[model samples]
Target: MVNLIRNENMKLYRRWRTWIMAALMIGAVLIGSFVDWHYDNKDAGADDWKTQITQEKQHWKEMIADPKTEEGSKNYAKDQLAIGEYRLAHDIRPESDTMWSGINGSAQLIMLITLFTVIVAGDSLAGEFSTGTIKLLLIRPASRLKILLSKYISMILFGLLLLIVLFVVSLLTNGLLYHFKQLDLPLVSVDSAGNAIELSMLGNLWKSYMLNGVSTILFVTLAFMISSAFRSSAMAIGISIFALFAGAIIMELTQPYAWSKYMLFANLDLSQYLNGRPYQDGMTMTFSILVLAAYFILFNFVSWFFFTRRDVAA
Candidate 1:
């Protein structure tokens, strides 16, 4: 199993697309950090912390009072108000455009990693079949299960490697662009009671990165299942990507229906729990986790069954 995994890893990393994806992630970090530094420098002396918070608080209050505001928007503003007030009370100034801020900001780019990984997952099995390499793989000593499992494991590791690279590069590039003076600073977050609590900067960043993993895992599993069930890499990749985006749109369109809460994409983003919000009123973190786990199991069952039972000669 170890040798099989190693072989799969080698095959994955040796591809030119793998290196190109890494370069794109590194380049994104550099470019985003540079832009952030430029803007932070411009705003550095524009207003004092207290003044900015005061204006922000006033804006939130106005948003709440506005009749045209949506329920979600008002709720979001209320959460922002809680955090903003906590920052003011604790003096956790606007994250100071530092390396740490860059690291936190880079969390947004996790979707890029997801996109790359989905393509890799969707292609892994189907591409082998498309190129007539699956026969060679099957003739090896390893069982079909081991080969498929090894490919899935390697794909996951590839995604993790990209994530680590993003964090490290963001830390280094932003450290060089700005400075690492705010290493001791703590992040302010709202607790369950809508009160602000201080959280370690590193702790918060890790949580943010892991929250992103929820979507990555779900969609990658979808791509993996699609790859195993189909012979065309293009079909697998295209359908998976479409579903990823379409899920969000469907959720938006079906917000009024109670059944929307049960949709796979609706529960994929666990980040909503971190901020004390769910897409719907009755949803919870535990519930979302259960839903995701159920789908994960279903996808894996279909992938394994179809991959093992079907004849490659077709």
Candidate 2:
């Protein structure tokens, strides 16, 4: 099994499509960082959003600096002032690291990895026939199901590689472009995990990296399902992305449609799912887990059944 997976991985990785996808993933990350740096590097007056943050900050400071303000309001103003002072001294923007980490984590990773997964997974068995590679694959004394599973596992890992590349690209591009040497990420509020475990600067980056990796895995599963059905790599990528966009639009167009609550994309949004604000109530971590598990099982079964019965000749 180990050799089988390795062989599949190497073959998939060597394809022109594989490297092209990786290049695109890296490209996407750089593009995102550039867009981020464009605004973040600008002065506070350059954009409306920046102006808003600055204005609100000043307003709050005034509320506190006002001599007649209530004691509680004054105290609250002091806290904001301290935080604000920390920002001005450090020259950090509102988001700095946390915001980029999240944006790359979900949007960039999901779209890039999903596209790459569709190509790799869609071509898994179908490419065999498309490229006359099926004969070689079948001659290896392996069952069709085993070969399919091998590709499934390998492609899933490939999806994760997309996310890993995202991290590397963001670090390099954002680091140089923004001239940010290092960041101090505030981990625990001296509240969440007790005082014993304080999160360090490096630890924050690592945590964000790991979380983004997990999110990639979840999004890739859907690609696997779509790939299992379609013979064309293009179709698989299209269907996977279309499903994502469609789900989001469904939620917006028909709020009364309670079924929108169960859309995979709706559930894939772990943050919103955890928060439960934009959607209806009852969306918690446990609920997201259950939703993801249901999709995993259903998709796994669908892929297995379809691939097992698919016409290799077709």
Candidate 3:
């Protein structure tokens, strides 16, 4: 198992797409930081800078009425209460406009990463046949299932590495480039008028980070399965990314499909989960996230079963 895993790891490391993603993440952080630095120095004695958070919250709240969910109710109450508590707290807004827009672009890239993961890992078994490498692999003592698992595990690790690099880059750049010098920040929720719940700054960051990591893992598993079955890297990437955007559109087009919550792209935002924000009116973050977990299991089963049962005739 260890040797098989290492072999897969070597293959993943050699892939240039993996390195390009990491580079993009770091590059975005650096560029964003520079932009933030210029804005901070250029504007002085103006409170409009802090109004971004308030404006976004107000806009977001208007988009969904009550969300009518248990978690939504809780968040609403907490956010309202936060407005009361943080009245005399800080001079700045809870979050920045750049934070709202800038971070979203980076977040979108995660879905792209999921597609890449599927094309890379899912195709591991199928590719052997596509390229006639199955003959060489079968010459070994390892079971097909074991070999496939090694690729999946390596893909997961590669995803983790990409996220880690992104986190470190975001932390250093966001902290230094933006004037958010203090690591200790008050927790503010959008549910309330201004401030609802308050947590230490460090606590919030760690919580946000972990949720993002877990959600990414769930989305990648789906892509992996598609790749395994299709053996067409382009198709795997195309479908996964199309789903990332199209799933919501389809979900909206027909409300009768209650199973839309189970879609991979539907659960992409980890922050919403941590914030106790509802992805949909009927879905709790935990429940919606569990849907993702179930998909991961199903995909794994299909991939393993099909790969093991298929004839890799040379």
Candidate 3 lDDT over 176-268, as tens digits, reads 544444444455544334435455545655565566666556555666667667655566556766665677687666546666666665666
lDDT of 2 by residue, 201-249 (tens): 4455555455445545655566666666765556665676677557778
Top-down TM-score ranking: 1, 3, 2
Lowest-sum lDDT 10-residue window in model 3: 96-105
Each prediction's TM-score against the native?
Answer: 0.91, 0.72, 0.75
lDDT (tens digit, per residue) of candidate 1 on 66-168: 9999997988888889888987777677676556667778779999999999999888999999999899899988889999899999888988999999888
lDDT winner among the candidates?
1
lDDT of prediction 1: 0.86
lDDT of 2: 0.62
Flag regions of model 1 displaced more than 4 Å.
58-82
Candidate 3 ranges with C-alpha deviation above 4 Å: 46-81, 87-93, 97-109, 178-180, 190-195, 256-280
RMSD of 1: 2.5
